[model samples]
Target: MSRLLLLSGGLDSTAIAAMTRPDQCLTIDYGQVAAQAEARAAKQVATLLGIHWSMITVPAREVGAGLMTGTATDPQGPPDAAPEWWPFRNQLLITLAAAWGVTRGITVVEVGTVASDGARHLDGTSLFLEAIDHVVASQEGHIRVRAPAAKLGAVELLTTSPVTEDVLAWTHSCHRANLPCGACPGCTKRRETLAAVGLLQ
Candidate 1:
C-alpha cells in the first residue's frame, strides 16, 4: 500500500521517516512560529533519505494558541496544559494530511507520536490514534493513520532507527523560533534526546 509520513522535522518524526522510508513525506505549515525552519529541515531530511517531500500551508494561526503561535501560553487552555500545546493540533494535522493523502492515493498516513507525548497531550496517545484511524478509514479513501513510533521514546526511536547524526543535524525542534532557543520545551527535549543517544556532546 502507498504510505505518506507527516514529517515535522523533529527528532521523532525524522527518525521515523529514516526508518520507514515512506513513499512520500508531507510537512505542514499551519502558521506555527517555526514553520519555516521546520519546512526547511523536513525538506533536507526527505532529500537525504531519497523520499519525495511536499509542504502545504493551511494558515491556522487564527485558531492556534500557546508557544507554537508565538504566545506565552494559552489562557483558555486547561490548567495542566503543556506550554506548547495547541488545541486539536494533532487532529487538525491528521485531517489535513489525510485530505492531501486521499487524492494522492496514499493508503496509510504515519505520524511520529512517541510514548512520552501521551503524558503531555491526549492526542498523542494510542487511543487517540486508534480513534482517528477508525474515523479516517471509515471515510472515502479508507486511509489509515498509524504511529509506528508510538510505543517508543525519542531516544529509543533514534537508537532503533537507521537515522544517523548527519540526518539528525537537520532536525529543528525549536517551537519558539527558527533557530534553537535552547530554553523552550521543544529545544530542551531535542537536546536531551540527542544526548541520550550520544549524538550531542
Candidate 2:
C-alpha cells in the first residue's frame, strides 16, 4: 500500500522518516508553542531525506493543553497520565493524515510514537492506534496507523536506521521553547536517547 509518514520533527520521527523514506512526510502544526521550530525541523529532515514535505495547520492554541499552549510540562506532584498531553491529538492527526492520504491514494499512515510514549500520553500507544485504525478501516482501503517504534525506545529504534549523529541533531523536541529548554521531558528524553545510543557524552 502507498504510505505517508507523520513527521513530528522529533528524534524518533526524524529517524523513522530518514530510515523509511516515505513518499511524503506530513507535519501538523496545532499551534503549539514551538510550531515554527517544529515545522522548520520537520522540513529540514524531509528535505535531507529527499522526501516531499507537507503541513497541516489547524491552529489548536485554544485547545488549552500545556504542551500546545506553553504552560508547565509535567505539572506538580505525581506524574499524571495526561501530563503534556494534548486532547485527542494523535487521533486528530491520524484522521487528518488518513484523509489526506486517501486523496493521494495512500493507505498506510505511520507515526513516530515510541514505547515510552504511552507512559505520558494515551494516543501514543499501539492499542490506541489499533483502535483508531479499526475505525479508519471501516471506511475502506484499510488505511492503518503504524508506529515502527511502538515497541522500542529511541536508541533501539535508531540502531538500525541510517540516521547518524548529524541527522539526529536536526530534531526539535522542546515543548515550550523554540530552542530546546533542556529541562522539559522532551529534551531530557532526547539527551537520554542520544546518550543511550553512544552519540552523546
Candidate 3:
C-alpha cells in the first residue's frame, strides 16, 4: 500500500521519515511563520533520504492563533492551550494530506507525533489519533492515519531512527520565523531533544 507522510521537518517527523521511508513525503504551508524554513528543511531531508517530496500551500494565517501565527494566545483558545497551539491544526493537516493522498491512490497517511506532543496539545494524543483515524476512515477515501512513533519521545524516536546527524541537522523546528528564534517553544524543544540524543553538546 502506498503511504504518505505529513512531514514537518521537525525532530519527530524527520526521525519518522528516516525510519519509515514512505512512498511520498508532504509538507504543508498553512501560513505558519516558519513555513519557508520548514519546507526547505523537509525538501533537503527528503532529498537526502531519497524520498519523493511534495509541498502544498493552503494559507490559513487568517484563522491561525498563538506563536506560529505571530499572535498571542487566542482569547477563545482552550484553557490548556500551549503557547504555539493552533486550533485544529493537526486535523487540518491530516485532512489536507488525506485529500492529497486519495487522489494518488495512497492508502495510509502518517504523521510525526511523539509521546511528548500530547502534553502540549490534545491533537497529539493517541485518543486524537484514534478519533481522527475513525473520522478519516469513515470518509470516502477510507485512508488510515498512523503515527508509528506516537508512543516514543523525541529522543527515543531519534535514537531508533536511521537518520544521521547530518540529515538530522537539516531539520527546522522554529515556529516563529525562518531563522530559529531560540526562545520559542519549538526551538527550545529541538535544542533539548538534540541534546538528549547526544547530537548536541
Candidate 4:
C-alpha cells in the first residue's frame, strides 16, 4: 500500500518522512510568510529521500487569523508561551491531505506533528488524530491518519531516524524563510533542540 506524507521541510516532518518511507510526499503552499522557505526545504528533502512529491496551492490571499496566513501573529517572532498558535492548522492540513489521499487511492496519510506541538497546536494532539481518523474512515475509503512522531521529542526523533548532519542542513524550521532570523521562537527552539542532541554547531 502506498502512503502519503505531509512534509513542511522542517525537522519534524522531514524525520517522519524518512521513517515512514512513504511512496509519495505532499505539501501545500498557502502564501504564508514561510512559503518560500518551505518550498526550498521541501524540494531539498524530496531529493534526498528520492520520493515522488507534489505541491498544492491553497487559495488564501489575505492573512487569516493564523501563523500560516501571516496575519494573526508574526511568523518570525519567537514562539511565545502559547506561540501565537495557528488556529485549526492541523485540522485543515489533515483534512486536505485526506482529501488528496482519496483521489490518489492512498490508504494512509501521515503527519510530522509531535507531542511538543500540543502545547500550542490543538490539532497536533492525539485526540485530534483520532478525530481525523474517524473522519477519514467515514468515507469508507479505509484511509488512516498516522503520526509516528506523536510521542517523540526532537532529540528522540533525530536518533531514531537516519537523518544526518547533511540532511539536517537542508531543513527549514525558520518561520521566516528568506533568512533564519534565529531570534524567532521557532529558530530558537530548533537550535536548542539540535544543541541538546549535539547536532548543532
Number of backbone-clashing residue pairs for each candidate, in the order shown: 0, 0, 0, 2
- Candidate 3 runs further than 4 Å off: 73-76
The stretch of ten residues in a row with the least summed lDDT in candidate 3 is 70-79
Error of 4 at 157 (Å): 0.5
Q: Deviation in angstroms for 127 in model 4? A: 1.0
Using TM-score, give the best candidate's number: 1
Order of all candidates by TM-score, from best down to worst?
Answer: 1, 3, 2, 4
| 86-146 per-residue lDDT for model 3 (tens digits) | 9899999999999999999999999999999999999999999999999999998899999
- Output the worst ten-in-a-row residue range by lDDT, candidate 1: 71-80
Instruction: Summing lDDT over every window of 10 consecutive residues in candidate 4, give the lowest-scoring window.
Output: 75-84
Report the candidate with higher TM-score, 2 versus 4. Answer: 2
Runs off by more than 4 Å, candidate 1: 73-76
Put down candidate 4 lDDT per residue, 1-201, tens digits, no spaces.
778999988888888878878988888886667878887888889889898888888855353344455555553333452444555567777888878778788888989988787776677788988888888778857788889899998778988888777877888887644468786667887898899888777
Sorted on lDDT, best first, the list reads 1, 3, 2, 4
Lowest summed-lDDT stretch of 10 residues in model 2? Answer: 74-83
Model 1, 79-175: lDDT tens per residue?
8888898999999999999999999899999999999999988999889999999999999999999999999988899999999888988999999
- The candidate, 3 or 4, that scores higher on TM-score is 3
Tell me the deviation in Å of residue 167 in model 3.
0.4
- Residue 183 of model 3, lDDT score: 87
